[model samples]
Target chain A: MVDLDVEEPNSGLFVKGKLEETNPVYKMVPVWEKDKCTFCGNCQKVCNFNAVIQLHTQVLVFPKLCHSCYACSELCPTDALPMKPEKIGEIKTFHQDNLTFLESCLNIGQEMAVQVIAHTNKILEKDYQGQLIIIDAPPGTSCPVIEAVKDTDFVLLAAEPTPFGLHDLKLAVDTMRKLKKDFAVIINRFGLGNDKIWEYCQRQNIEILAKIPNSRTAAELYSHGKLIYKQIPQVKQEVLKIANKIRQLSGEPK
Target chain B: MRIAFTSQGSTWNDPIDPRFGRAPYLLIYDEETDKLEVIDNTAINQVAHGAGPETARKLFQAKPKVLITGNGPGGNAARVLENANITIYIGAGSLTVEQAYKKYKNNELKNY
Candidate 1:
C-alpha cells in the first residue's frame, strides 16, 4: 500500500510498520548574485510566480513563490542566477507484515504537494514488486489527484452519500472520464443520507463496487486506530468480497 | 505613450472592468496617434491559474507606458508590470474606459 497524500498522510497511524528508510525530495531554486546583477529586472519580468523582485538596488528571491522552472536563471543576461536544491518533502518506507508501505510527507509550509507525490510514485514504479498495489490518493479533482491516479489500473472513488459527496463524486467522475481511466464508485457511510448518490450512479451507469454502512461501532474503532474489518466480522466479509472482486477484475490469481 | 485599461466592452463607452486579469477586454489607447485598440481578454476567463501573469506578459509585449484599470494588479502581475517600467493607476471605479484614460491623462487617478 502506498499513500500519495503528501499534504496529510495518515495511513501510518493505522498500520503497524517498522520504518526502514527516509529520503528527502528537493527542487532547484534560483539564487541571485547582487554584484553581477545589473538590476535590469529581467528575472522579475520572466518569473511567473513573482518569486524574483528588484527593489531599488537590491533584488530579492522568495523561495516559497518560486516554482523552480529555471525561467529566471535561463533569461538572466549576466548569468547571475544560480540554481540551488532546496528540500521540500521526504518519502518514508516501512514494512508491515508482508506489505511494503510507502508514504510521502510534505514539509511544513510547503505548497509543492504534486512534486512530492510524483517523487513517491517514481520510487514505487522503480521498486514495485507487488502484484497488486493499492494507492491512497489525495482527496480532490485537482492536479495532485490527477498526478496520483494517472496510468493506474483502476480508480476506486470513495465518497459519502450526502449531497456534498455526490457533488464532488460527480466532479471526480468527470475527471476520470476525461482521463479515460477505468473506475467504480464506493459509497462510504451508506444509508446515512438520501438516495441521491445511488440514483445518480444508476443514471450515469457507474458501477457501485461496494457500500460500507454507517455504524457507530465502526466509527469508534476507526477513531481508535483499529481496523473496522478486524473489529466487525460482517465488515470483514464485505472487504474480503471486495478484494475477491478486485482480484477477479485485475486477473490476479487469488 | 500607450495606456491600457481593463474594460467590460470593446468600445470607449464601456465600463472600466474591476478585474485586471479576467476582464473581458483590454482597451489600449495610443497617445502618439490618438488611436484606441481593443484586445479580447475572454480567453483568460477559462484559465484555471496564472491568468494575471499571462495577461501582464501580453501587455508587456504591447509596451504600454501606463496601465489604467479600475482595480490594482495582483502580486504576480504587479511584478511583471513593474519590471517592464509600466506605471499603474487605479480608482477608475464605475467609469467608462475613455473617462478612465481622461482621468489618468489629467493626473486625477491614484497611483499605486
Candidate 2:
C-alpha cells in the first residue's frame, strides 16, 4: 500500500493504497562472446539500431545504441551471446505514516531508460495490490519518457508557464494521446506569469487538476533534499485533497 | 559490368546496392553507352544506416572495370574493392555515369 501527500495549498491532494498490478515491460541487453562466434555476423546483421558491428579482427557492441531487446542473443547461431542483469537505474522507496515516496534515477552513459523503468516496476512489491502509484517521469517526449508512463493510470503532466514549456508540453501531450493514456495538467509555480497556459487548457477542454504558487520554502526544501509535504504540513494536507479529487475522477474509493 | 560505390554504409566485400543518400550513387557508366548499373552499396533501396559486406562480395563477383565513389573511401570498403585492381574514382559522385567514363577515357581521374 502507498500514500501520496500533496505539497501545495489549494493545489494539493493525498492518496494512500495499493496500486494495480502491471506486467514487466522492459528487457536487458545480452553480451556475446566471439570465441564461440562463427563470425557469421547474424547478430550484427539483424540489429535495427546498428548497435553491433563486425570488424575484420573482432566484433564490437555499442552500449549507447543498445535497447536491451536481447535480439542479438536470441538470434546468435553459435550461442556466443548471453544476457546478464544490467544496471540502468534504481528505485528509492520512502515511508511515512500515511505518505509514500518513490524516485527513479537513470545510470550514466545509458541511452535507453526503459531498463530503469523496468527495474522501478520490479522494486514495487507485487503483494501491494491496492496502492496508488505516483510517478515523476523524466522530461521529454521520446521513447524513454514514453516507456516510463506505459502502465500509468493517470499522468499528471507538469508544465511551466512559458513558451518553451508549452512547446514541449504539446509534444508530451501528443505522445500520451498516441498511447491512449488518460492525463491531467498541473500548472507549477503559478502567478509568476499570465494565465496563457490556463487559457489554452480551457480552450482545448483539457482538465486543470491543480495550480501551485511559487514558494521559496518549497524551493529550499527541495534543495535540502527534503520532501515539501514533510517540511510544511499545509503542503501535505493539500496533497491529500488533490488525492481525493483524483480518486473522485478515477471512481476509486476515497 | 557491375560496379559498386564504397562508403560508410556500403558493403565493399559483397555485391550490394550503392548508398545513394550518404554519398553519390556509385554508378558504372558505359563509355560508349549511357547504360548505368549500380554496384555494391550499403544503402540499397535508399536505406543509408548500415553497411553490408555481403553486398561487396557480390559486387566483386560481377567484376566491373571502373569503381566510382566519393571521399572517405580508405576504409575496409576501399581495401576490399582495391583487391581487384578496379580503378577507384574518389569524389566522383558529382559526375554523370557518362562523364565518369569520359574522364576515365581521357585518363584524367586517377586512383588515390
Candidate 3:
C-alpha cells in the first residue's frame, strides 16, 4: 500500500514494518543574484502570485509564495535569477513480510503537497510495477486528491451514511465523472446514519461495493492503534469481500 | 486625469457595481473632456483564474489615476493596481456611477 497523504500519512500505524530507506524531496525556486540585478521590477511585474517584489535598491523573493513556474527566470532580461532546489518533503520506504509500504511526509509549514505527491509517484513508477497497489488518498476532491487518483485503474470512494457524507460524495462523484475514471462507492460506519447515500447511489446508478457496519469494537481497536480486521473475523470477512470484488472488477486472478 | 468606476450598466445613471473584478462594465470618466466611455468587462468570460488581476491589468492599461469601486480590488488586483501607481477608493455602495464620481471629486469616498 502506498500512502499518498503527504500532509498526514497514517497507514504506517496499521502495519509492522522495518524502516528501509528515506529520501528528501526538493523543488525548484528562483534565487536572485543582487549584484547582477538592475532593479527593473520586470520580474515583479511578470509574477502572477506576487512572489517577487522590487523596493528601490533590492529585489525580494518569497520562496514559500513562489509556484516555481520559471516565468521570472525566463523573463528576466539580465539573467540575474537562477533556479535552486529547495527541500519540501521526505519519502520513506517500509518493508513488511511480502508488502512494501511507501509514505511521503511533507515538512511542517509547507504548502506544496502536490510536488511531494508527484515525487512519490515518480519513485513508485521507477521501483514497482504490475502489483496490487492500494493508494490511501487524502480526503477531498481537491488538488491533492486529484494528484493521488490520477492514472489509477479504479477508485473506491468511502463515505458515511449521512447528509454531509452525501454532499461530499456528490462532489467526489462529480470529480470522478469529470476525470472519467471507473469507480464504486463504499459506505463506512454503516447502519448508524440515514439511508440518503444509498438512495443517491441508486439514483445515480453508482455501485455500492461494501458496507462496514458501525461498531464500538472497531472504534476501540482504532483508538488502540490496532487493525479492526485483524481482531474481528466478520470485519476481516467484509474486507475480503471488498478485495474479491476489486479483483473481479480489475480482472485479476485471486 | 482619467478615473475608472465599476458600473453594472454603461450609462451615467447605472448603479455602482459592488464587485470589482466581475463588474459588467467599467466607465472611464475623463475629467478634462467631461466624457464617459464604457468598456465591457464581460468580454473576458473564459478566464479560469486571476480574474481580479486580469481586470486590474486592463484598468492599468487604461491609465486611470484612480479606481472608484464599491467593495474590492482583492489582494491580487490591489497589488497590480498599486504597482501601476493607481489609487483605489471605496464605499460607493447603493450609489450610481455618476454619484460615486461626484463624491470622489468632492473627496467624500474613503481611499483604500
Candidate 4:
C-alpha cells in the first residue's frame, strides 16, 4: 500500500524540450535475524534460485537467489527472522539531447529487480502530461520482467535479428500474452540473417513497431558506452523515430 | 490432545478401509487421555474439496498445535496455517495418521 509516485525526466516519454520527472516509488526487501537462526536450512531448501545455502556451522544467503518471496521469514519457527528494509535499486533521470534516458542500475548482489522496477513503474503510470516512456527492459520473462511491465502503457520489445534472439523473443512474447500485456516488436539488426523473425511476428499478428538496421557505427558507439549523440545523427534520428512510433501506439500526444 | 488419522474412514463405526478421499480418517490424539481416536473427515463431507484448505484449516483449528499430513497446504493457505503457528509435517504419505502423530511426538519428523 505504499504510494509510488516519482518523476523521471525526459526518457523519451516526452517530446523535445519538455521537462518531466518520474513519480517516486518505493520498493522494499526482507531482512533476517541470525541470532535465532538454527541454520535449519529451510530458507535454503525452499529458495528456487539457490539464493540460500547452509554450511557446516552457519547458513549463508546469496542476495541474488532471493526473489523476495518472504516465505522463509514467514516460515521461521524461532521468530528469529524478520523483514529488514532494503532498497533493491532505483532509476535516475537523464537527458541525452532530446531523448530522455532512464538509467537504472541494480544494486550489486541485489536479489529482487522486480521491486525496483515496480518503483520505476510508479513514475511511468502516473500523469505524463502527454509524453512517451520508452522502457529498456532487462532480458527474460521471469518476475523481474513481469514487474517491469506492470502499469506500462505499452511494451515495445527490442530484439535482435538472430536465432537466439528469436528464441528468447518467443519466450518474451509468451510471457506478454500470459500477462495480457499489449506489446509491439522493434526488430533491431534487420537484414543481418534470416526472415524467421518477420515470419514469426506475422504468424503471431504482432505489430512491427520499428526496425533498426545492423549498423556497425551504432554497434561501435554502444560498445564504447557512448550515447547515440556520439554516433552519426542518423542513428539517433532512427531511434527517435522508434520512440515516436511508440508514442503513437501509446496514444499519447506530441 | 488426541489426534485423528484421517485417510479412509472418519469414524471407527465402519471398517478401517484405506480409501481415497472418503477413506481418509482424522487421527485425533488426546495428550491428556493418552488415547488416540481416529475419525472421518465426515464432519466436513458436505464441504467441497475435502482434505484441502478448508479441511486443513479445520484440522489446525481443533487446537492440535501440530498436524502430520501427507500433503502440505500451499499459497496463502499455508501462510495462514503458519501464521497460526501450527507445526506442519508434510510428506506424511502412506503413513497412518496415528504413526505420523507418534513420529511427531517422538520428534522424529525433520523440519524444513
Question: Per-residue lDDT for A1-254 in model 2, tens only?
Answer: 22111111111123232332322323456676868888887887787755566654356665556676778888998788787666555444445567655545555555456666655655554634357665556677865577667777777788887877778778888888999998888877766667788888888778877776667898887766566776666566656767887787668989
Weakest 10 consecutive residues of candidate 1 chain A by summed lDDT: A49-58
Report iRMS values in order.
5.1, 6.3, 5.3, 13.9
User: Which regions of candidate 3 deviate over 4 angstroms?
Assistant: B1-112
- Candidate 2 to truth, TM: 0.59
* Model 4 alpha-carbon drift over 4 Å, by segment: A1-64, A75-78, A95-101, A123-131, A224-241, A252-254, B1-112
TM-score versus the correct structure, for each prediction: 0.71, 0.59, 0.70, 0.51
* Strongest candidate by lDDT: 3
- Evaluate all candidate structures by whole-model CA lDDT and list the values in order: 0.85, 0.58, 0.86, 0.59
lDDT by residue (A1-254, candidate 3, tens digit) is 89999999999888789999999999899999998898888987888765676645666666666778999999999989999999999999999999999989899988788889988888777778777788999998998999899968899999999889989999999999999999999999988889999999999999998888899999999988898988888788779888998788668887
Which prediction has more favorable DockQ, 1 or 2? 2
Q: Which stretches of candidate 1 lie over 4 Å from their true place?
A: B1-112
| Candidate 2: Cα lDDT at A177 | 91
Please write out the lDDT profile of model 4 over residues A154-183, one tens digit for every residue.
777878889988998999999888888888
The better-scoring model by lDDT among 1 and 2 is 1
Candidate 3 chain A has its poorest 10 consecutive residues by lDDT at A53-62
| Docking class of predicted structure 1 | incorrect
Candidate 4 structure quality by residue, lDDT tens digits, B1-112: 4443445544323333233233346666678887766554665556342224444444554656665555455443444455556666655555655566557678886552
For residues B1-112, could you state the per-residue lDDT of candidate 1 as single tens digits? 8999989999989999988878888888898898988888888877665667667767877778889887789877787688778899999968998888788879999997
Sort the candidates on DockQ, descending order.
Answer: 2, 1, 3, 4
Q: Best to worst by lDDT, what's the order?
A: 3, 1, 4, 2
